[model samples]
Target: MAKMTLESLRKLRVEQKEAIERRDTGDKSIHIIVGMGTCGIAAGAKEALNVFLGEAYTRKMTNVVVKQTGCMGLCHAEPTVEVKMDGMPDTLYGKVDADVAKKIVEQHLLGGKLVNEHVFDYPARDIHKE
Candidate 1:
C-alpha cells in the first residue's frame, strides 16, 4: 500500500459526504428500510439491501431512500423489508429474497402496487400496550 496523503484523505471524505447528500437530498417520498439485525443478516437481508440499492441506482432514482435499520420485531420473518410510500400505508414484506426486493422496487416503488402474499401484518404497539 502507498503512504496516505492528507489531501487524498480529505478528498475521500468529500466524496463520502457527497454520496450521503445524494441519498438524503431528495423528495424522500419513498423509503425502503431493510432490517439488518443479526437474524435479518443471517437470513439474507444484506443481499436484499444490495439488490434494492442496485435497482434504485440503475433507474437513476433520487427520490427513493434505501436504508438499513435494526430488528422490526418479527424474528420469524428475518429478512423483512418495510416500504413507506408517499400516500400508501407503510408495508412490511417478510422472507424477502433478492427477487422479492426487485419486485418491491418495480411494483411498489415504480408501479405503485404492493407485492402480495409476502406482506406482513405486524402488530403496532408493544406487548405492554396490548
Candidate 2:
C-alpha cells in the first residue's frame, strides 16, 4: 500500500466531515425518508432516492434533509416515501416513481402541499417487538 501524504490526509478529513453532514436528522425544518429495502429497490426506489438527492442538490435546498430507511413494511406499496416538515403532519406516499418523487419535492417540499393521490393509510406495525 502507498504511504499517506499530508495533503491526502487533509483531503480525507474534509470528505469525512462532509459525509457526516449529509446524515439527515429530524431537527431539520424539512426532511425526507426514502425506503431502500429489498422490495423497494426491486420496484425502482433507488432511482427515486437518487432523484431526491439530485433535485435537492440541483436546487441548493439546504434546509431539507434527505435520508434512507429500510422496509416501511408496505411491500405491496413498494417505493414508499415519507416527508416530514415542521408544523405539518408526517405524510407517507406509496408507489412512488421518479416522476412522483420530483412532484413531491416541488409540490410538497417547495409548495407545502401534500400529494393526496399518492398518499395512503398503512397500518402501523410493531416490527421492533418482533
Candidate 3:
C-alpha cells in the first residue's frame, strides 16, 4: 500500500474532525444513511435513498442530509437505514423500501417520533467500562 504524505494525513485528519464536529453539534437536522452494498442494492436500497433525498428536498429541509454507505454487517436485513438526530438515539431501520423511507420522513423526521418496531437499537458498549 502507498504511504500517505504528511500533508495528505493532515488533510484526512481535518476531514474526519469536521465530520465528527458536525455529528456532535446541536443541529436539529437528521442524518440518514442508506447502506448500498450488493445485498442492500438488491433489496432496493437505492429506491429508499432516493425517496429520502427527494422528500427532504421537496420539504425544504436544509438541515436534513442524506448519504450512502456500504454494507452495515446485516446482510440478511439488506437495505438498512441509519438515522441520527441531535438528541435522539441513532436508529437503525432494516428491510427498508421506498414506503418505509417515506414513513421515516413523515413519522421520524416530521413528527419526531421513532418507529419502534422498525428500529434496531443496539446498545453502544463503552470501551472504558470495566
Better of 1 and 3 by lDDT: 1
Candidate 1 residue pairs in clash (backbone atoms < 3 Å): none
Compose the digit string of candidate 2's lDDT tens values, residues 24-111: 5435567898888999999999889899999987776757678998888888887998898876688889999999999999998888
lDDT of 3 by residue, 1-130 (tens): 6998999999977986686576674457689988898989999899999999899877757578898988777777778999998767788898788888899999988888987778864323441121
Q: What lDDT does candidate 1 reach at residue 72?
A: 83
Candidate 2, RMSD to the unseen true structure: 5.8
Better of 2 and 3 by TM-score: 2
**lDDT of every predicted structure (CA atoms):** 0.84, 0.84, 0.81
| Angstrom error at residue 114, model 3 | 1.0
RMSD of each: 4.5, 5.8, 9.2
Q: Model 1, which residues run further than 4 Å from truth?
A: 1-28, 127-130
Worst 10 residues of 3 by lDDT: 121-130
Distance (Å) between predicted and true CA of 43, model 3?
A: 0.6
Q: What is the full ranking by TM-score, best candidate first?
A: 1, 2, 3
Reference-based lDDT, residue 64, model 2: 69
